[model samples]
Target: MTSTSTSPSAKFLTAQRSELLSRRESYLADMARSTATALELTEDGANQDMADEDGFGEGDTLNVERDRLLVVASEAKERVAEIDAALARVDAGTYGACEACGKPIPEARLEVVPEATLCVNCKTGASLRRK
Candidate 1:
């Protein structure tokens, strides 16, 4: 879907693109940090002697933290992918249109979520369907 007269302005699109790029960079950095922390936790756990008095509980705690960090990294990676897709849409001249309904997404919504691909109604329906 392409933008219409009522769609976001060129300036708005440019700003959104810049914002998306910045967010993508941030997300990538977050992913790297989280992954590194998870790796460090894994290595630390591996080096600890299993026969220590408190080793079992400490290892379990480290494992939980490592798992949480992994999840954070994965979520950041997904956000980066979404930002990339939004940048592609900006380049393709479809940045402000809903991908599912081909409607002009409200500027307010775009302002809040530049990477959104669907209008609020479509997104709500999709979310419901997912459940």
Candidate 2:
């Protein structure tokens, strides 16, 4: 097939890339806020280690919340990193190409996941890597 991105595909990718970048920025800001809150609470001795409403200390509850928040924040950070990498690909003129097999990822897939690094087949293989 086609070696280059079609005009329509290129337009879609551009829009998708822009949307992903916006999402990445929002996530990064959220993560930074979460990290700062984590630090603040930690410094204030609010990191709790207990569960339950009244049986547990405030510190324990805070810790649990912060821990959960950290998990989410980390995932968001990873997404942002992925988006950044996709942006780099755009700059390098390979924005819509699959990283795994060097094929053009379908526009439909890219529209759904702007930060995708693999085409459908490659992505499926990767998802099964743990098996």
Candidate 3:
């Protein structure tokens, strides 16, 4: 059934959409900050002269920080992509359904993880298979 103003499903989907959009914006901001920090660290490392021992240590530290920031940025980007996919599912009227089992995902679980594509049982099974 399609979402209508009077339907509880419609309200749930609307709430999910709002939460997903908020999370997407937060992740995007995090990615931007992390990327900027990484870039700055890279630039700082490049500007340091590596001929001296202290320069070498400082540069190494900067490189390590940059790597960490890059990882953070990458994770944020991945989360943003997931959130985008969730938004797409919302638009397609499949937001509350499990992709793997075609069952309705619990509201509690959805409240905790708005981007979840699989229900708990399927998710557990998938995780077990991966291991």
Each prediction's whole-model lDDT (CA): 0.90, 0.77, 0.87
Query: Model 1, poorest ten-residue lDDT window?
Result: 45-54
Q: What digit string (tens of lDDT, one per residue) describes model 3 on residues 1-131?
A: 56543222877888989999999999999999999999988877877854455688888888889999999999999999999999998887778788888888888899899999898999999999999
Q: How does candidate 3 fare on TM-score?
A: 0.88
Model 3 ranges with Cα > 4 A deviation: 1-8, 50-54
Best by lDDT: 1
The lowest-lDDT stretch of 10 consecutive residues in candidate 3 is 1-10
**TM-score: which candidate is best?**
1
**Residues 38-99, model 1: lDDT tens digits:** 99999889877455756988889999999999999999999999999999988988788888
Task: Return the TM-score for each candidate structure.
Answer: 0.91, 0.78, 0.88
Where model 1 places Cα greater than 4 Å from the true spot, the runs are 1-3, 49-54
lDDT by residue (25-90, candidate 2, tens digit) is 898998898888877767555323323346356767767877877887898889888989988887
Tell me how candidate 3 scores on lDDT: 0.87
Off by over 4 Å in 2: 1-9, 46-56
Scored by lDDT, model 2 comes in at 0.77
Q: How close to the true structure is residue 66 of candidate 2, measured as C-alpha lDDT? A: 76
Report the Cα lDDT for residue 102, model 1: 92
